[model samples]
Target: MPPVKKIVMWLVVIFLLYAIFTSPDSAADIFGSAWDVVANGVRNIGRFFDSLISRS
Candidate 1:
C-alpha cells in the first residue's frame, strides 16, 4: 500500500484497540466473546478426535 494509506490503517487500528481496552464494558465483552470462541473450538476439536478414534 501507499505510505499514506498504511499510516491511516495503522492509526485506525490503534484507535480501535485503545477504545476497546479503555472501555470497561467493551473490554469485558470482547474478552468474554473471545474466551467462549476458544473454549467451544477446543471442545469441538476434542469431539472430532474422539469420533475419529471410535471409527478406527
Candidate 2:
C-alpha cells in the first residue's frame, strides 16, 4: 500500500479504538446496524440464486 493509505488506515483504527472505549453502547449499535446491512445483502443474494435455480 501507499504511504497515504497506511496513514488513513491507522487514523481509522485509532478513531475506532477511541470510540469503542469512550462510548461502547453507541459503537455496539453502529456495528449492529452494519452487520444487519451485510446480512440483508447476503440474504438477497441467496434468494436471487434460489429463484434462478428453481426456474431452470
Candidate 3:
C-alpha cells in the first residue's frame, strides 16, 4: 500500500484499540452496526442476482 494509506490505517487501528479498551460496550455497538450493514448489503446483492436469474 501507499505511505499515506498506511499511516491512516495505523491511526484507525489505534483509535479502535482505544475504544475497545476504554469503552468496550461502545466498541461492540459500533462493530455490531458495521456487521449488520455488511450483512444487509450482501443479502441485497444476492436478492438482486436472484431476481435477474428469475427474469431470464
Instruction: For model 3, give the 10-residue run with minimal summed lDDT.
Output: 1-10
* Best prediction by TM-score: 2
Compose the digit string of candidate 2's lDDT tens values, residues 13-55: 9999999999999999999999999999999999999999999
Question: Compared with the true structure, what per-residue lDDT tens digits does model 1 show for residues 1-56?
Answer: 69999999999999878978789798778789999999999999999999999998
Candidate 1, residue 21: Cα displacement in angstroms equals: 5.5
Tens digits of per-residue lDDT, candidate 3, 1-56, equal: 69999999999999989999999999999999999999999999999999999999
By lDDT: ranked, best first = 2, 3, 1
Give the runs in model 2 whose Cα sits over 4 Å from its true position. Answer: none
Quote each prediction's TM-score: 0.61, 0.95, 0.87
Candidate 3 residues lying further than 4 Å off, grouped into runs, are none
- Tell me how many residue pairs clash in candidate 1: 0
What C-alpha lDDT do the candidate models reach, one value each? 0.92, 0.99, 0.97
